[model samples]
Target: MYRVIQFSTGNVGREALRMIIARPDLELVGVHAASPAKIGRDAAELCGLGEPTGITATDDLDALVALGADCVVFTAQAETRPDEALAQMCAFLRAGTDVVATSFVWLVNPRSADAWLLDPLREACEEGGSSLYVNGIDPGYSGDTLALAALSLAGSADRVVIQEVFDYADYDDGEFTGVQFGFGLPADAEPALMATPGIVASIWGGSVHLLAEAMGITLDSVSDRWETWVTPTPIDCVMTKVEANCVAAVRFAAEGFRDGRAVIVVEHVNRLTPAAAPDWAYPPEGRDGVHRVLVEGHPGIEINSHVGGGEISETFAGVVSTAARVVNAIAAVRAADPGILGVVDLPAGYAGRVMS
Candidate 1:
């Protein structure tokens, strides 16, 4: 059995652990926690499974590697220091272990990060005969997978556009709430936190290029814009305004082009809508706003799909299910030559199932 070492105890890590537990072929080997509170606890407890799995969270990097794990699923946030995270991935690869992660943006856009870190990783994987890949719900499926799904519907096209409109007003996580919809800090405060180079440009920039390459378009240049404003009043919700730390509305949008020709338009908003009565006319966008993917191309065809657009429970369930699919694709992770890797990299014969 392949031993899977989960590197974080965060929400995404927990979700991945659940999938691993349900899959019969895989074994949960160890849990590595960066926090002291979680250290020495059963991996099952970290995942809220109510029981320990003999595996305990550890902070000793070398000890974690000594466990003879076949692969590691990394979800720990390196925050402003992504290089530290990259170093860990390099170490894992060099130690003869494969890795699947969603930490640094370089996992999606390796060209931007210091090649000093990535080059060694590529070399390590080659020498160690191990595979490495990074994917998640947002950058993993929503942007990449969704884009490829739309392209599958097209024959010949000069350009394809994918748009995802999600209601940030409903997101309640503190880490996300602070930057929901691109709102980094108060409008009047010091330079917005989300306006920094990394948050605004680096985050979605990779997705734009990933989509462009999937369609075989060589992008000449890329530009983006962000807007953040407060709601008329406070929104009281479980995760949206409350947990998301969204006091008002936050919106982030970007447009990509090839040689002055528009190719893709993508936008994300936190708390973009207001509360309304149940029977109120919710309009075409739906009550939770709209999560849609629109493809405009030959003969003017548009395909739009949304999250919570039909069934609210199914929409949330889809996120969890897609996360599981991302974990299952761990075995397919491969090193690339300094460019964006998109859904096209996933082979047509790929079944999108758990790796044995």
Candidate 2:
């Protein structure tokens, strides 16, 4: 069994903890919690599992590194703290622990990553002979893998568009909804860092590059565009109130051009409430969320993924899938060559066992 340590117990991290305990091939060695209330609690209790695993949460970074576990599942939030997240992952990698993370989305394709951001992690891997992989559902399976798979069925492809459409009303992350995406701000206000110049390229650009590489197509340039929609009426959600004329929805697109035309594109339509942006593309059958991959080709193909159903909200389902993508890749990452690894570097069937 591979000894594993989880970095946090947030949305994604909690699911990681549950999967770790449920998998017979994985053993929980330690867990780290940023909140004082979570520290010293049993791992199982923290994850809401009935049984106790005797592994208590700790805030001691040194103790976690000293565990010398086989791998560390680092799912801590990196959008607001990229530097700190990088340092933490590097420290664990230098301590000889392979890492599978959902924090740094750019690492999905390290070769396309910023040199300054990726070089240190590469050095850490060399120093400790450990490997690192970064992935999540959007920039992960839905962006690169699924897009590429769909393109394979095309006889001749001209453009590829991958889109994520979701209603974030039930997503309880106030900071993310209010600050990061500018969801509750005035419609005319500047967008969050994600929609700013070069940010989307830095995050989702790797997916574009990955698809181009798989298709043997060269991109001349990449660009981004974003727009916001305002609610005409007041809307209520778990996070905050969306008063009239406030930012209610955001639509952003990042495109890779080939010979002056877009050949690869990643687009997001995120709305705070369903009523806020009723005209945006939604899932078939009135589903709340969907990830769609469209390949414009001789035999054009469109693949849609609608994950959550019943009581499961789209946000929670996304969180769980993100964690599963990282956890499922743990074994393959550990067995990979020491360095920054990408989806293309690993085998096709690295996803862990299926659960009914």
For residue 253, model 2's alpha carbon misses the true position, in angstroms, by 1.3
- RMSD (Cα, Å) for all candidates, in order, is 4.5, 1.4
**lDDT by residue for model 2 (147-218), tens:** 878988999888999999988888888776567788878777666777779888878898888888877888
lDDT of each model, Cα atoms only? 0.61, 0.88
**Segments in model 1 whose C-alpha atoms lie over 4 Å from true places:** 109-117, 180-185, 239-247, 272-291, 304-322, 334-342, 349-356
Q: List model 1 lDDT by residue over 8-39, tens digit each.
A: 87767777787676576678887788889999
Query: What TM-score, computed on C-alpha atoms, does each candidate reach?
Result: 0.82, 0.96
User: What range of 10 consecutive residues in model 1 has the weakest lDDT sum?
Assistant: 276-285
